[model samples]
Target: MVEEAPYRRIAAEIRERIARGDLAPGDRIPSTREITRDWGVAMATATKVINALREAGLVETRSGAGSVVIDRSSPQVEVVIQPDVPAHAGGFHVAASPRLRRAGEPELNRDRVVSSAVAIADAEGLSMLTMRRVAADLGVATMSLYRHVPSKEELILAMIDAVFGENPLPEEPPADWRARLETAARQMWQSFAAHPWAAEPLSLTRPQLLPNVLPYSEWSLGTLRELGFGVDEMMHIHLSLFGHVRASALNLDAELRAREDTGVTNDEWADQHGDELEAVLSAAAERFSALRYVAERGFDYDIAAVFESGLRLLLDGVAVALARREVSGDEQVDLSVV
Candidate 1:
């Protein structure tokens, strides 16, 4: 007779309680923190216990709420996929996938914690992301999260690293310096677009030293160095490119908030209030000629296009500086003019 695993045994106990109706549906279940205290088990074991219960279709995570018993009578229940556990093995029939981890549901770890935080920040703005919110998203105890991440600041740092790590820099970048710089800038832009909340935290003035981001810096700076640019020039150019992306990305969160609050996109919102805007512009046409001129023609705003155009202009300026440096024999090229 082999001994059952501690996690399985604890899971069985909870399962029995649920079956007996002692832990009724819609009632909050013991969090991982509670389970560890009650069962005298490790936090990982506690997570496994919850994983088992969740896999059995006995509980579901509610946003802004912790795990609760699932109502058997209800037609739908949120399902959390466990990587090791085969899907639809014993749980209720899942009609659709929830906006939760499924493709690769690895065990709870720092990476998982960071990924969850990223997801939350991506869906909702960073302002709305909290420890409790991430815990609820993971269907684990908020305290258990601390075992993996010491603090929210640490978790955020980890999140920044994780986002940057998604797209690896090429080992052999494009031979052309301009092409290399453009490649790096566009990659950074894509990352910010994916997780709009990430841009602000990745500061320009007081930059967070992220391991994954170091390669990008090396690639960008190395490209400049190969082109004979001085260290000062390299840093300035790199920052200029980085800052451009960050500046555009900074608006992403605010734009997202407006869309969510107003339930319309920028263009839609403008159209909805177009008459009022036109009336104001019409009244102040002489003073606001430029505004009225563009307003009359209508501006189609696309952040991606704006970012690309800005990147091109910045690189063009860099090219001019390089040209000046070549002619001046390594002397510092003045960048005050175009």
Candidate 2:
């Protein structure tokens, strides 16, 4: 129902080119930035154009390859003209390599729509995700995506199911409980790192019921249940483990975006801000004991080192929890409950 004025402009331009053989299906088109520079438009406007082409089934965003036209011979190509791209966009990456569905296929469904949405989020950010934006990416009517999902929230939840489902954890875990949990954490971390945008929609305390996510929960709970804990206790422990991953993963997306925007690491940014930090420290050192202590320590720690240390500390806590479970009458838990 929503109308996209800017996306319409993008669709219109690309349609003209395709019809003229200036660009063909399977041909890689310029990236959003390239398109923006070529067309002399703002970055936001450029992003819309590419997304629109994607929705129309004319283009697809591929890592290392950029955006490519979906296919050369497809059924829907003749029917779809310049579809409008509604203003605004958004979403996170699902997988490093996406399975290209095809160009101009009538068999489009929810999975394809959500898949494209995930691709956009992977390439861009969650703030840019919208039904209109997603449709623009698919090169379809904005209304077309509505046939499968009702709202962005529903789409996001389904995306989590679809994306997370693609990488299922082991039904059988390793012998060491810590090692098994570490494996689980690493997998989750890789998922976040690959699709940094995945974390933006997730809430730590109020996670939605997802089959893929639930399995991890089942594994965690089963691990605890064998450790002489009741079902409720197991649930609590399961939450704690899940909380660790989600909370840490939450920062992954923002950190990556900050990197892209500034093209600097956190320490680099801090080094650039060193003078400012020095001034603030000088001013507040007298009032704050913590500031005086660090100043007296006379050390500037690398942020990357700090991040790694923090990660170690987090895992250390898990190790401690496991150790406590061992000392207690708690029996060994079977973590692999797939």
Candidate 3:
């Protein structure tokens, strides 16, 4: 006789849509903002609606992307709703997907857990990643994930290691030191580009000792060591190059989040504010002549392009230093060489 809670009512409606095939698997459901706008509900109520659906195994939240219907058709995974329950009852009966099954059945293991976590992190920023989310994606119970991965922190470390492993260092790296360094730097950058969320957790002060990453460090340091630089210089050079790449890679996630929130691309945003930008620059024409000049000419801001330029500049500086070290034993090399 009691009226249903707002969230349960909203969740039931969405569940009905999924049942009627109006929302299929992998289709994004309404965002919190969208739900609030459509239903005239508070943000908290909208959030509860999403959580309820997620708990019921009907949707999975992707970080910047809204919640999407999870595929339930796989014979390997199954979800059961209790029969004869009223739509507003707000209860779901679920059977946990087995971690181990018959020979032909898919088995949950360390690799599956790590890989699923990585995929989630890649799509949604690490902020959206949770054990429950990963289990939902894999069609297993949240607790089942803990059996393979001890904790969220450990799961993150494993994810990083797995990504690094994707681009293994060549068994026989390039013979030239410059080529070798370039190759190493590009490999690291590629990994960062593919997985934008990876840059932050890989701390410089407390570096994760990933198996695949160590080979890169060894190769970079060894490249400098061959140039007759001492261990100190070699380490410094390696860290410097790494810092450069990491600093640039961090932008990928920030920009992605910005775009998602604003629903506009960088160029589109620039276009929208073009007049305002020009007016600001024009007002301080004399004081900000250089800025005004670039603005007038139209600057194209590309992250990948900026990263490449900085990388070349840093490597060039290293090259110049090496040349100087060779020439004067103490004489400075001309900066023009770069």
TM-score: which candidate is best?
Answer: 3
Q: What is the lDDT of candidate 3?
A: 0.77
Estimate the TM-score of every prediction. Answer: 0.68, 0.67, 0.79
lDDT of 1 by residue, 87-196 (tens): 43223233322224444566888877887688657654576557876775676667999999999998888988898898877778876777899889988888888777
Candidate 3: misplaced stretches above 4 Å? Answer: 1-105, 330-338
What TM-score, to 2 decimals, does candidate 2 have? Answer: 0.67
Tens-place lDDT per residue, model 2, 270-333, is 6787788778878877677687577556566443344445556665765566566656747564
Candidate that scores best on lDDT: 3
Q: How many residue pairs clash per model?
A: 0, 21, 0
Report lDDT per candidate.
0.75, 0.64, 0.77
Q: Tell me which of candidates 2 and 3 scores higher on TM-score.
A: 3
For candidate 1, the per-residue lDDT at 4 reads 73
Cα deviation at 1, candidate 2, in Å, is: 32
